[model samples]
Target: MGDLAAVVAARGVPAQEVMDEYARTLDRLVDPVRHPSLCWLRESGRLGTPDEPDHDFRFGLERVLDGVEALARGASA
Candidate 1:
């Protein structure tokens, strides 16, 4: 989930766009394919592929969200 989020986020895509892209990625994964991915792959303007997997991405995402939560709380206080 977060991997997908990171993809759209990295692309300078908005949160809502990221969500829509994520859903489509999931839908694409859900169907019959040679490889089912939890994350969507982007070219990154490079010819190489990413070495990390979806788990690594989501791990960072959880931390990112946690940080956001903390920031929000601090701002509220």
Candidate 2:
């Protein structure tokens, strides 16, 4: 996730309060009727916060490694 790293590097870490304010703004802006999918995402609480900078990167890397390991196991078998 080079893009994620780049964004984090460029912006640095944002304050939790600032992020919370942005989340609130998003809540207000996303109309349930007009953007049902976005509304669902907003309500789902899956929109991760910026508390941990490397969380998403680490998660993606772990999933990729898991897939590679599975493929290796299949090939050996």
Q: 1-77 in candidate 2: lDDT tens per residue? A: 45444555677754444556667988888888999998787677656355466777789899999999999999999
TM-scores for every candidate against the unseen true structure: 0.32, 0.46
lDDT (tens digit, per residue) of candidate 1 on 39-73: 33322222132333475667779999999999999
* Range of the 10 consecutive residues with the lowest summed lDDT in candidate 2: 1-10
lDDT of 1: 0.57
How far residue 54's Cα lies from its native spot in candidate 1, in Å, is 1.2
The prediction achieving the highest lDDT against the true structure is 2
The weakest ten consecutive residues by lDDT in model 1 span 38-47
TM-score of 1: 0.32
* Each model's lDDT: 0.57, 0.72
Any residue pairs clashing in model 1, and if so which?
none
Error of 1 at 34 (Å): 45
Q: After superposition, how far is residue 14 of candidate 1 from its true place, in Å?
A: 37
